[model samples]
Target: MVAPPDNDVLWARGLHHAHGGTSALAGVSVGVREGEILAVTGPRGSGKTTLLKCLSGQLVPSEGEVWFNSAPVHTLSSPSRERLRLDRFGWIDTEPHLVPELTAWENAALPLLLRGTGTRSAKHTAVEWLDRLDVGMCANRRPARLDQSQRQRIAIARALATTPQVLFADEPTAPLHRSDGTQVLRTLTTAARSHQITVVLATHDPEVATLADRSLALLDGRQSGAAAEAAGSSDEESRAACSLSV
Candidate 1:
């Protein structure tokens, strides 16, 4: 694969968003490196989902810029942006949102099928991801047959089946128990690292943030104090002093 011109595969600058005149994001800027996991963390309404949507083109920002590789996402036509998302990006929302009637593997294959992969090949890839996520036995079950955690794993499998260039996960484990969440996250991060997939993870969990190569904290849609900055600093003292301990 050809190397990108810069380390950051995704970039956003001075992002601002408002829904019904209430600001969700305000002047948020961030850069995510290629093949690295970045955690976006905060309390509810901190604009975690909004930031992810804007960066991934799910929601166009009211103002600011988002760039994918060398392409300006904000300036692209709607169709172009849609194609970009379908072809190069993957998204895992807090909810699984699986098709109730579709089997697990079928639901996982949705992206591949949408992208025109042959049925057999799509199923193969989907099953592989589900197996990797430890949901192999659930592959034939429809959403209604499985519990919330199982459904979420299927959703994760669907996102990974495409081997997308970038993966955006917003509170992916919010629906599971601590043990289940830990296992699922371990599986997700391992698979992502093995594939060298860049990840933008949004969560309020400190344990989850420690899994990332770097993290950013948001408060009321804007980046907060220098805590995250200090964590990533090259200074030995800062590294030694980081509270996350990872």
Candidate 2:
């Protein structure tokens, strides 16, 4: 399937975030396009995660604007934002927040069930995603009983189960070893492209950065001129050279 136009997903212009004396992101502008995986990479406290939050509408930007499908997200009402978050966005944090007592399937089904889908249908959908992620064997296992990699897979299944239009993942492969991390990243990008979901991942891993269609680096809460230019450049040579090296 053809990817959606760049304007169809999230767009940020001159976005900034600050608290006390620190800046998270300064004058950051980027676009997340459907079927494209955008990676945000930076050092600790560089505002990678903060940028993700602003784009996902978890945190309002201190300056500039964030547009979701051409609509300014910050201008939307609370209920409208919540509705959009529930139906259109999927977020996966660094730590998988599965319930200790609930089985993997149950954890994956929670969102669908909360949306009023029948229990049977929710479980069915959850199992399908679990299977797709090659974790169906853990369907009945609780988070406490699963390994870190297993937990990560469950998190991925949950994120994709809803088939959201936008997927925001923060350090999705942070806990895994190199090989496992690559596998997980591949899984996420493959699923997203197949479903035409726009993906934005905040990570410090070089492998993750290399896999992204575009990469942006945040330094001391600001994007370097070189990085910003790379992010804005359309030329293939420039894009490959623009990726964050470290």
Candidate 3:
């Protein structure tokens, strides 16, 4: 097997995956440089999430290769992949999934704690991320007490507290109001840049994709430049109509 490029922190080639006989990804290949923010754009069902999952080692593609830091991720044993994720990768889901029983700070600190970090250090790091994400004031509250945006922010803090080398964010702002989403995304991107973190962000929103340094668009589980352009035009027309509505 050929090694990935020296400069790419994450790389994949000829990826193919299917779900219950339906293709989710088809011959998808990508590379992400260290500390670069790459936005994966497409309408729903365009394989953005599947690609992220494969790259992040959450799911092995049925066919193809995935590499991280010159190592072949697709060939690693399941336990090794799990350990790699726990140690070096972070993920933010479309919705907040904080533990209802834990305080926000505790929830944020869970990853470090699970990794055997000292309790004090874990709390300190978690609180720092919470403050950065604008959720420090909610640090002591349980998930049930926090609003959706606050909970989501806490979840982001949790992901950031570990300071993983790579962060996968799949439509992270989908659950928030546009105003809330803007602030959260600004904070997320700013923190990632400042920390020199590699980010693979998947989003359907053109505005969101614009924040990344680069973008890769997909359609029907395959990369398509023309389809992406057409989709962008359609989205712009829809936005114009929305602006004209009462």
Candidate 4:
């Protein structure tokens, strides 16, 4: 396979995947540049999550090539892929998925601690991210003690504390109320911009996609035309709003 473009931090071409003989992605190709926020938008079951999973090395495509920093990700062994994710990628799921036994700070610092960071350093970093997400007051509380919105914020803090090279967020605000989701999403995109972390955000909401630098729309497991027109728009002012909003 040919090497990916030098400017692309993550790139995939002709991707195809199936789940138990059922098609999920069909010849989908995408590229994300460093520090760029790319939203994968579509209806439910439109292959957004599958695409994200493939690009993030969580799933191997049945047919295609995935590259990160010009290195072939599709060819990496399972253990190597796990290592790469631990070292370079952060992920936030739709649910909070916080550790029930640990306090919010401890939960947020889990990744850093797993990476062998000092306890003090991990807590410091986690707390800083908590404060940024307006969930610092909940740092000492366990997941059960926090509200749904608060728990989601802690989850986001956990993802950001590592300052990962790339972050994969799959419907990160799905568990929150509309107002809460909007605020949390704003904070997320803003933090990503400030940290220069490339973000691949999967969402079914068009308004949510607007916060991204570009959007890729999928339909029935294939790329659609709607997003193609808007993908290259790159509204600088719109993206700049993230910095100003938070």
Candidate 5:
């Protein structure tokens, strides 16, 4: 197989996946440019999450290849992929899966701590990101003590604390109100851009898609009727704003 381009942080070719004989992805191919935010937009059951999982090495494709910084990710063993995720990739799931027992700062520092960073240093970095996400005041609160949006912000803080090479966020704000989601999305893209982190954001909202530098839409587990980056006529301004870096 040809090597991925040097500037493409992540690449996938001819990706396909199936669950219990049902197709989740069909012949999907994509390239995420270095330091750029790429949106994977599609409706529910449209293959967005499956495609992301395949590309991120969280799930192996039933067919085809995945590369990370030109390394053969799909070809790696499960343990190797786990290490890759621990050391180089960060993920934000739809739910803010914070440990209920841990304080906000502690929850955000979990990843860094798991990676063996000193506790004091990890807490400092975690708090700094919590502040950036505008959740600094909640740093001492536990998950049960915070609202959905606050918990989500701490989750985002956790993902950013390590400053991983690539970040994958799957319907990250699905549980929040529109206004709350918008603000979190804005903060996420801004942080990703400022840190030069490549982001692959999965969402079903048009407004959310607008924040990405480029977008790929899926339909019934396959490419849609239009080309990649094709936006609705109403989103012209949003597309043009792609270069705004948030």
Candidate 6:
């Protein structure tokens, strides 16, 4: 397993969210250390995805704050937030977000191109990651033409192409068969560690959780009592001294 970096990469302090009267997440606080894998596991409606959105700056928290490398994500300008997300954070949703018209390689290279990398160089890096993930054969195939597992692999390859500081995956194995799901999870986790990227995954799969260095369970829009207690006890003494100085 890759060691967590000396810096804190992501943190959520007293995060809360709601939709109408329903609470999606309440007082959820967690910190993801650089280069570590933190798995969030919970039942449906447990706010795992909501927490991810808040941390990624896609959705603002209702009553709390999310910090990325000591900067409040919600306070950044749109362009700045977007640049941060693109350059430092990588997100992989359950469904593949590849463009239907673009081939897998093109889709994977899109982010790099957006960040000013030349087409040839970005495509070369994309192809290299695809090869690493064993999806090189699908490089020229459009997402519509690839099977579910192939498309998922392409999405992961795209996420890892930039060597992001933090990688978030939401139920990455939801659409795959048991064997394929395991393979994808293993590939993603291993690659993240090899690159020293912090990984935060939300899933209900026990097998997936087992791969994490730490796992937290959520229930009814809040982390489970036991999980919360453990986090408090273990993380407080070690992390409190280094809380975001800003």
Best by TM-score: 4
lDDT of 5 by residue, 110-160 (tens): 999999999999999999999988899999999998999999999999999
lDDT of 6 by residue, 1-246 (tens): 122233778877788899888999989988877777888999888999998988898888888777887678867777888888988999999998789999999999988988899999999999998987789999999988899999999999999999899999999999999998987887787787767789889998766776676787889878784333223334334223223221
Task: Give the clash count for model 1.
Answer: 0
Clash counts per candidate, in order, are 0, 0, 0, 0, 0, 0
Clashing pairs in 3: none
TM-score of each: 0.90, 0.87, 0.91, 0.96, 0.93, 0.88
Using TM-score as the yardstick, the better of models 4 and 6 is 4
For 5-93, candidate 2 gives per-residue lDDT tens digits of 45657888888888777878888988776666788888888888889888888888888888887678866777878888898899998
Instruction: Give the TM-score (vs. native) of candidate 6.
Output: 0.88
Give the per-residue Cα lDDT of candidate 1 at 70: 89
- Of 2 and 4, the candidate ahead on lDDT is 4
Q: Indicate whether candidate 1 or candidate 2 has the larger TM-score.
A: 1
**Tens-digit per-residue lDDT, 137-204, candidate 4:** 98999999899999999999999999999999999998899998999999999999888899999999
lDDT of each: 0.86, 0.81, 0.88, 0.91, 0.88, 0.82
**Candidate 3: segments with Cα more than 4 A from true spot:** 226-246
Candidate 6 runs further than 4 Å off = 1-6, 225-246
Which tens-of-lDDT digit does each residue in 124-180 have in candidate 3? 999999988878999899999989999999999999999999999999999999988
Poorly placed runs, candidate 2 (over 4 Å) = 1-8, 225-246
Which of candidates 1 and 6 reaches a greater TM-score? 1
Which stretches of model 1 miss by more than 4 angstroms?
1-5, 226-246
Better of 4 and 6 by lDDT: 4
Which of candidates 5 and 6 is the stronger one according to TM-score? 5
Please say which candidate is ahead in lDDT: 1 or 2.
Answer: 1
